[model samples]
Target chain A: MWLRLNLRHRIYAILTALVIITISGGLVMVWYTYRMERLFSGIIGRDLVGFQVAAALEASLVHQKGFVSYYYLDGDPEWLRRLGEYRQIFKERLREAEILSDTPRQQEILESIRSEYNEYIQIKDRVIDYYKTGQRKALADVHPQLRELFFHIVDQCEVYKHIFTDQIQEARAEAHDQAEQLRYVAGAAILLELLLALFLAFVLVSHILGPVRRLTLAAEGGEGPGRIDNEITALSRSVRGLIQDAGQVHLELERSREHLLQSEKMALVGKLAAGTAHSIRNPLTSVKMRLFSLGRSLVLSDTQKEDFEVISQEIRHIDTIVQNFLEFSRPPKLQFQEISPSTVVDMALQLLSHRLDAYDATVTLQRSNPLPTISGDPEQLKEVLVNLIVNACEAMGRGGAIVIREETAVLPRVGKAAVIHLSDNGPGMSEAVAAKAVQPFFTTKDEGTGLGLSIALRILEEHEGTLNIQSAEGEGATFTIALPVKGADT
Target chain B: MKTGFDILITDHNPHVRRFIAREMTAAGYRVQEAECGADVLFQVSGNKAVDLLILDPDLPDIDSAVLLQRLRKRTPALPVVIHAFSSDMEDHPEYLKSDRFVEKRGASIEHLKEVIQDLLIRR
Candidate 1:
């Protein structure tokens, strides 16, 4: 399901799953910590209760008559021997109680028990001295206070035992409550974690993967990259870029194929034109020769002479059209030479001087200090200049300035060649027209064959030059011809 | 200029052949015409005095290079001029190891006359 999702959704789902795992892991840790704390508290409470009970029992034993008798007869031979044996038993029991006390509360109770036992021992020693001195009244007078002290200590022992029992009961209840609370909390955490995990899984599979699934369907449906949107826009962008690149490549291939087909068609046309021209040239030549000979031989009427002149002019026009067709279709072999571009421009301007004068268009040359020499057929370069100048003149119609600028600058280095830019400024073409200007037979003028620019472009390509056009609707057009400057080795 | 030599023009088109013939006649030279290589060979074999041959590079029957070699074998001294219409001539310059190459499109009648006159004078 996640694989079916788009890239963006897939990333989001992965993050969500990670978050869920992290949160669930944290909850489990909390639950474990809570359980361990509860167990520790219960053990401490049990130790405290056991220490309190042992301390109370030791206090009661110290206040009993057996304890008093054992301490008072310490000087008598038999009684002293019995008292020593009882003291040993009492010390053993006190050590056992101290060993049982593990918690801080248990240790405090054992300390109190040790201090009270020491106080009882001091009282027993005083009573034994009195008995040894034979002080009968004194022993009787101290007898009441000793009995009262003993009874008071016994009451304290009973109170201590009761408090220990109460504490033990409270601790047991707290432990039970903690256990129940732990079970509830652990169960709740597990349930919540499971629900959260399920929710996260559902979110990943539904919202995130849902759109991705749709995208996959769309892609498989052949709807292409444009159909994707929203969070998956990056994927859409990349897909769109790929699709656009492919489309452009396909379009370029189609254009190339069309160009090849057109060239084939033009080749056929050229062959036919050549044959037709050959056939027509003979008859036309004979007619012209015969007409010239007839004119030399006869004195014709004005009307007949006018008719002959018209016929001759018409034939000449047809001849010119046919010649243009042949020249345009079958260009002459290129004899490439390293020639100065300025010289070619000069020649072109000289040839078009009359037309420039008619249009009142000025030709300006802003040349580089030392123009690089380019290798090209001189005649073909002249033709390109002628065509461009003529086009500029036609565009200006009434009158406009034509600037022919030459600049020598290195293009971004591609391999080992530099590019020279020759730009022209004239009444510019619209984007739509400029795009189609290089196409054969795509004419903007009524009398134009539209072959001039096409032929110029072909000639430039033959010279390994690229022609680029930049123009707006109103702000004139600049045609920049970039020719790869020959390197030193070439 | 005594009609010093007889020339054979071999081309597929009758109009081209006639044009060449007329041009040669105007230059005061004897001219013969053949529409194909076989006709040229037949005419030459049948006792026609053929001194020079002006041929189209593309012939229907025989390859132009092969025809040139065969003609060279037959008449070692005969000067041949190849009139090529296609730019494919650049690929096969060996075939054009002839006396001269006259491009048909740009070469005027005067130019053809000059080449022939030069050849005759040189001979």
Candidate 2:
């Protein structure tokens, strides 16, 4: 079930677990350290208090005796033994205090205790001396001084006890404060980790899961545009581009297949044309010879002569049509040269001027200023223009103006190519026809071989040029040709 | 109009060989026909005074362009006419270059006759 969750949720869960473990471990360590510190502080406080009480009791005994000979003069072994026991206990307490002292302040306080303790011992020795020598006058004279010295020793012991107790209390307070801080920090850390985990989960859901879901929905052909998240936006864009490129590739492949099919069809036509022309030409040659011979032998009537002339003319027209068909079916061997587009257009216009005049149609020429020359077959380009112009003239029929314009505009946004648009106001083709205009042997004309546009398209393709067609039913058609401008060879 | 030179036409297709022979004969020139590259080579090597060699690029026994090269080596001055199936002769001019290039389809008989006559006269 956990593995089934998304990555974001999983990450959040893992981090939350880590934070809880870390905070709990830290709190546990702090609690343990506090307990140990309190324990040591209690032992130090008890030892210092015991030492102070023992010092006070010994001082009171010395003060009541007026001198150190009170116990020795009375010969009280019990007091002496009690004092020895207290001294031994004090020595043990001092050793324990030294063990507890970790700082310089605590060490200084211990050193003071040692020095005051030694001074008390020296006073006790003096009292013992007075008792041993039987010096009553000396004991009476030093009585007040001894009392003062004992009180001073008691004061020092009290001060040492007070200092240790204060230290123990301060350490306990600090440990309590630290433990409280750790608790607060752990609580805050756990809370923040929870919030962060929740935030991360939300982000993952929206940025990753949301986009993926939308993509799936889109793939399923759901309605409306898919909603994409920020994290997937880049990937989506790239995928969109890849899809577009694939579409273009598919289109190009389709076009190439169509071209191959057209070429195959043209090859078949060429074979047929070759055979038909071969058979027809011999018979036609014989017919022409026979007609010539018959015309010379007979003094024929004017009508007969005129009939023969018409027959010959009709034969010539048939021959021309067959020849054109053969040429259209056959592929052309291109002669490439650097030629200006204007020159090709002008040549085409010149060839078609008479037809245009007969139709009462005027031809207009609009050329790019200082048109750049392109590397292509000039004769082929002219043939393409001638075909287009002648077709336009035929469409206009009685009379219509044909607008021939050329421009060298940079189409960098589309691709690095120079574009030329040729628009005409002649009768435009239907969408269906326009789509298949470049297909071989597909023509609307009664006598059309239907290879003109196909050949032109092939030539343009050979020159690495694109032929774009735009047409409406009555608004006329525009043909835009885009070719890459040549740069210096590397 | 008859010319002394005899033109030999070699092609895998019988129709193309016959067409070329007929056109050449019509133009008043003697004609010989070879169905394959081997037959062409055999005829040329057997002391047949062949003035022009009209061959298709793809033949049965040998590659037409290579045969042309071999023929050129044998008879350097023989004007060869290449009849290509496709229009992309310009792309492979180095290999397909002959005295004249004639497309198998849509070529005028007059054009072929005129070119052959020019070559013979020049020779």
Candidate 3:
């Protein structure tokens, strides 16, 4: 249950417990010391004074004993006067002892001592009177009795002194017992404090420091030693890194989702377009045949002939569009053959020679060396080349010069590849158009099917190749084609 | 005025078949029409000497690949002209195994006539 608390709460609980123990233990020690101080004051200020007064009373009683005897012997009335003075002193000391008395037992003993001393004094005074009256027999008998009273009073005073002494002894003993109790309590508090300290250390080490060390290691990917002094600092750095990585992953996932949605939409459109194109093919073919037969059979004026030719040309254009849709929707099976890329290039130029002448475009093939042989569909490659050339020609409109450069290079991730760079000396495309040039159905031309570059890219991808378009407004466009060499492991 | 060569024209569309048959008949060859795979097979199995077979790959009754395979097995020496869209021919290159491929287009009749003349002369 203790382990379930988080680092902050765990430290808080331990610190709180430690503080409570320390404060309560300190308070108990303080209270014990105060009690001890009060006990010592009581013993010194009251008990010790009471004991001293009791002794003084005993001394005065003894002094009067000898003074009364001296009066009996010398007959000097000055001795009698000194005896009265000692009596006064003894009475004053008894009063002081009574006032100092604290417990009921000590007060009672003092009262008994006062009564006995009074009795003793009265008997002694009687003896003095007998002496003064010159009654020798009576004086001797009373003197003996007086001597016994004096001894009894002195014994009572001794008992009163013992009472105060006993109180002092009791106070000392009580203080000792309290000090012993305080010792035990202090020892227990110290032991408890030690245990709490150890527990706090244990919690900090195992629960906090251990995990933080491990977290720092994991966050650093076990790459480096502890460079940061503070563990939390390193952890925060790692957390920042992880957060950044998570953000990038989220962005990538969003992009992929959008791309998937776009591909699915294109796939759906392709399916619909293919179906429509296939259905239209048969009827379109019948119309073509009828037109063919009509033109061949009928005799017509030049205007009629021109109209007929225009209609036929429009029908052919529609057919071409339908064919493009079908081709885009259903990719043809590639016929891979071992051939040099230069061969395909030559074929494309030969095929497009008449179109080039019509468009007034000149092509210069930079055949430094025949391109490396690769396994690909030559017909599809030729088609792509022809399409690019035709587009370049149309862009230039007239007097366009196209340069075809071919080479072999080792491309990263594609290994050895046959690279073809077809650059046209014509007005290039804007960045936006260039970026979307390979997208299906994205076209700048009015009469374009817009599947040319898309189909070219698709065909290149099937051959494990790439098509890259580099163009800027007012600058000529450069189309780079890279086809991986056969048997080259990337 | 019919020539010695007998031609079989197969297509799912009746109008296309009718026109091609008309064109071929006018060109002095005896032409027969088959609208479906079954009809084409039935006509080919008949005793009539079909010197040539111009077949559209897309038919109603059977899979084109299977029909082409069957036709190749039934008449190994017969020259079959695949008269279909170029896109269709590209999709199924096995159709290229036929004697000739003539894309059905506006000016395709001249190409088709030339192919037929070449095939009959070779036969």
Candidate with best lDDT: 3
**Higher-scoring candidate on TM-score, 1 or 2:** 1
Give the least accurate 10-residue stretch of model 3 chain A, judged by summed lDDT: A222-231
Given candidate 1, what's the lDDT at residue A441? 62
**Candidate 3 — what's its lDDT?**
0.86
Reference-based lDDT, each prediction: 0.68, 0.69, 0.86
What is candidate 3's lDDT per residue for A1-490, written digit by digit as tens? 8767787898899899989989998899889879988998988888788778888989988888787668778989899889889989998998888777777887887888788777877777777777788888988778777777778778878888888788899998998898898889889888988998998999888988879878888989988575658888888888899999999999999998997897787788789879989899889989988898898889999999999989988888888888888888987688899999999999999999899999888888888889889999999999999999999998988899999999988988578999999999889999999989988888999889888998898889889899999999888999999999987665
RMSD of each: 14.4, 15.0, 3.9
Q: Which pairs clash in model 1?
A: A6-A212, A428-A477
Runs of candidate 1 with Cα error greater than 4 angstroms are: A1-340, A347-362, A372-379, A390-401, A408-436, A444-448, A462-464, A468-478, A484-490, B19-30, B62-66, B81-118
| TM-score of each predicted structure versus truth | 0.50, 0.46, 0.85
Report the lDDT of model 2 for residue A449: 64
Give the poorly placed runs of model 2, Cα more than 4 Å off. A1-338, A358-360, A412-419, A462-464, A484-490, B1-33, B47-59, B73-123
Worst 10 residues of 1 chain A by lDDT: A413-422
lDDT for A231 (candidate 2): 31
Let me know the DockQ for model 2. Answer: 0.06
